[model samples]
Target: MEKKRTISVSVVNEHGVLSRISGLFAGRGYNIESLTVAPIPESDLSRVTIVTDGDAKVFEQIIKQLHKLIPVLNVVENDDFLEKEMALVKIPIEEDIASIEVLCRAYNGNVANANEKYIIVTVTDKPYRISSFLKAIKKFNPKEMIRSGTVALERY
Candidate 1:
């Protein structure tokens, strides 16, 4: 069964590593829904979070390909884990700000600020929750939207 999976990779901090990793997915005809990369604090390594959809066989193949890359240090599929995504939306002040606030609150989100021309709403939640929130908020006519790629950690 094809399903969403989050893969966490540790790699040497060097140029082209991101392209190599992304190229592997592209070559395999797998779509990356979200990708986040950041250097590990005080280390010469980087962590990459990739969200993809595939069955077990395809996922294993993907991992094998990643491991073959010279810069890749480790690859872990965060199946038993907690994952979250964040989004910030700026909407024109045409809609009722109070109504938007209430909608955000319903999704465990918040309207961070309101100004004369626009309002900024922030949401941090599971991927689906964030999607739903965005869909719901669309009725207000968003002026801009920014989504952070997935970030995940294994559950103990």
Candidate 2:
């Protein structure tokens, strides 16, 4: 049986590294559900968070391939980690602001901006919570929304 897994990879900040890493999964007929990459502050390295689903054997192969990459410094699975995703949604300002604010508060979201016609809200939470919040706010008829891929750090 396949199981969902989150992998955190550290790599030397250099050209073509991301392509090479992504290629590894594509070449193997594997799917990356979500991928987020950003530089580690004050360091010449980048952190990549990948969410995927696979069986034990497949995950083993994935880890082995990552280990062989020239610029890959380390690979860690999310046995214990802190993870969060962010989403921005724009809804028509004509909607009831009180209800919208209540819904936002329920999901750790805030009204980030409000104009004459649209209200932009920001929500940061776990992936499932983000999805739930979107569904709950559908009554407001959101005009646009975008969500960030998951980002994580191993527990100390």
Candidate 3:
């Protein structure tokens, strides 16, 4: 059975490393649902969070392939972990501002930043929850939406 998985990879911060890593997935005909890469604070390394779907055997292949990359330092599959994704959605300012606010609250989200024309609602939750929030907000006709890649930590 295909299942969702989040993988955290630590890699050397170098040019083309991101592309090379992503290419590995693309070249192998695997789809990356979400990808987020950022440098570790005060370090010359980067952390990449990738979300993909595949069966257990396929997932193992993906991990083994990732490890073969030159820049990869470590890789961890976050199946047994605590994971969260953050998203900021910009909804147009209309007469339904109050209604939109209500929807946000219902999804464990909040209007973090607001402007005259658009309000930025933020949500931090599981990956599927984020998707649900986005789908629910579609009726509002969002001006822009941005989602962070999954960031996860293993549970003890």
> lDDT values of the candidates?
0.90, 0.93, 0.88
> Candidate 3, overall lDDT?
0.88
Clashing pairs in 3: none
Task: List runs of model 3 lying over 4 Å from the truth.
Answer: none
lDDT of 3 by residue, 26-64 (tens): 998888988888899999999998889989988999999
lDDT of 1 by residue, 25-113 (tens): 99889889899999999999999999998898998899889999999999888668688889999999888888998988877789788
Single out the weakest 10-residue window by summed lDDT for candidate 1. 75-84
- For every model in order, what is the number of clashing pairs? 0, 0, 0
- 18-90 in candidate 2: lDDT tens per residue? 9999999999988899999999999999999999999999999999999999999999985787888998999
Q: What are the clashing pairs of model 1?
A: none
**What's the TM-score of each model vs. the native?**
0.91, 0.97, 0.87
Better of 1 and 3 by lDDT: 1
Supply the TM-score for candidate 3. 0.87
Residue 116, model 2, lDDT: 89
Clashes of 2: 0
Pick the winner on lDDT between candidates 1 and 2: 2
